[model samples]
Target: MDKKKTLLTLSAVAIGSVIYNYLKPVKSDVEVIQDFDLQKYLGKWYEIARFDFFWEKNLKNVTAEYSMNEDGSVKVKNEGVNITTEKTKTSIGKAKYAGNVNEGALKVSFFGPFYSGYNIVMIDSDYQDALIFGDNLDYIWILSRTKSINEDRKAHYLKYAKDCGYDLSKLKWTVQEG
Candidate 1:
């Protein structure tokens, strides 16, 4: 009887952990950009910089393409080149606005049904540059329409990101060699 009870308790705890992880709310201090226009934002963007992660390790020349799906969801196609092998890698995902369409917060899923936060913290008027944040400080990205961002804009973004509590030291400047 004790063994069965222990097993049940363990299972319950495991399930609860999963639920909490997936449903945790975004940090209160982080704000999503309002007045976002998905139509203008949909296009190819170069990854100017990003926080290093396991999946993108040793990758360079990363680019992301966004397009509207027929069902009103956004289609995300990310491509990167392996620096050592010079081979390209691609991952396709889907995104849906988490709340109001004007808000820049979206739930993105590369793995089906397992959505993660994708918030546009800031975007230029021309949609040529953007700063993105995930649910927490673990994820951050700087993107641009061109391969590189100008020094002034880069400095401004760095300052903004730092002010937002992100550690800029972990940022990996992506190589965009065409």
Candidate 2:
């Protein structure tokens, strides 16, 4: 009886350890890119992949469009197709540089006056695609101008994210209609 009790306690500890590791946020040293050009970054970006979020549930063919507004803030329009419901969903938001313009840090809000972090940690030259990270490691998205991504680029981003301590098992490869 004592042996069985010991075995059960050990098993519980092991399971708890795994869950704790998964839930704990990755303390990243990853900084947003320097010399960030908000104007150049403004354009349509497809959701190549992302971590699941309630607002984006059942979404496919997701895309985010950015453009400059007269007030020097950015206008954001997010669109996605809900194939499950056979309907299109759209949300409009706005963004402004949260820090220095040279830093790839911005605050975006779809709701009135309430904003959230929208930082671009990794982006290639020519702005073809980018990796968007949130204030914490919980939120992440791989965005590209094109709907499809080459394996090479995808591999690079995956490795980088892993190195930054993200759990790759949680990544959801987004589905988009060509």
Candidate 3:
């Protein structure tokens, strides 16, 4: 009887852990750009700014390639060159629309053993620039197709970032080389 109770308790604990991890809240105050047009947004987006992460640290010439997949999802190919090691790593994933036209979000996952979060927090009217967030606050990125963005556009995004509770000082501008 004691052994059976122990097994049941362990089973309950294991189930609870799985549920906790799966149902973890990853939402932030950042609003999804509702006016996002997938057609315009689909392309090679250069990393303009990002919150530092180990995999992306000291990485340069980073860009995310997006393509439409037959599975009714957007294929994501994130490639970057490690400045320190001069090595390139490419991670492949897929994303689907999760919000409406005006307030749009995306859920992306690598063809992994498990799924992860990839949310779109903000985007420009022309879809020329965007800010993305992931499962945690640590995952933040600003992307643009061009190496440079207009001053006014930058200002607008910065304001949005502030509203989203991001520390402006923590935003590291990606170094683009011509």
lDDT (Cα atoms) of all candidates against the true structure: 0.90, 0.87, 0.76
Query: Weakest 10 consecutive residues, lDDT, candidate 1?
Result: 20-29
Candidate 2 lDDT, tens digit per residue, 146-172?
998778888998998888877889898
When summed lDDT is taken over every stretch of 10 residues in candidate 3, the lowest stretch is 110-119
The true-structure Cα RMSD of candidate 2 reads: 10.8
The alpha-carbon deviation from the true structure for residue 114 of candidate 1, after best TM-score superposition, in angstroms, is 0.9
Candidate 1 lDDT over 18-135, as tens digits, reads: 8878676555367889999999999999999999987799999999999999999999999999999989999999999999999999999986567778999888899999999987
- Against the correct fold, how does model 3 do in TM-score? 0.77
Q: Best candidate per lDDT, number? A: 1
TM-scores of all predicted structures = 0.86, 0.82, 0.77
Provide the RMSD of all predictions against the true structure, rounded to 1 decimal.
5.3, 10.8, 6.2
- The 10 consecutive residues of candidate 2 with the worst lDDT sum are 20-29
lDDT of 1: 0.90
> Candidate 3 regions off by >4 Å?
1-26, 99-103, 111-113
